[model samples]
Target: MDIKVLGPGCPKCHETERLVKEVVAELSVDASVDKITDLMKIAGYGVFGTPAVVVDGEVKSVGKIPKKEEIKTWIEG
Candidate 1:
């Protein structure tokens, strides 16, 4: 699975990345996580908010640090 965290290196963004890693580890899922910091690239995802989570090329959540359970659902779903 492919996951992308889109943000400008803010605290929330960092938290999201960390949580994503935790979720991936806990789930034992093989996935790639990429931090997208470039403004232009982030905009291409149609997300104006920071700390967005994208899974498998689909935007999962944006503008907030989602809970671990929610992230796990997204990852597994």
Candidate 2:
């Protein structure tokens, strides 16, 4: 699975990244997590939010840090 966290390195963005990692680790899922800190790249995701989560190249959530369970479910699904 390809997971991408998009943001400009804000607190929420960092939290999202951390939580995503935790979720992935707990589930033992083989996934690649990428942090998209570049403005151009983040904007290309069509997200104006500070923190965004994308799974399998699809935008899952934006503008806030998602719950770990929610993230895990997303990844598992």
TM-score of each: 0.97, 0.96
Query: What are the runs in model 1 whose C-alpha is more than 4 Å off?
Result: none
Give the number of the best model, judged by TM-score.
Answer: 1
Query: Residue-pair clashes per candidate, as listed?
Result: 0, 0
Model 1 per-residue lDDT tens digits across residues 1-77: 99999998999999999999999999999999999999999999998698999999999998999999999999889
Please report, in order, the local distance difference test score of every candidate based on alpha carbons. Answer: 0.95, 0.91
lDDT of 2: 0.91
- Across 1-70, the per-residue lDDT of candidate 2 in tens digits comes to 9999998998889999999998888888999999999999989989868699999988999898899888
Instruction: Looking at model 1, report the run of 10 residues with the lowest lDDT sum.
Output: 42-51
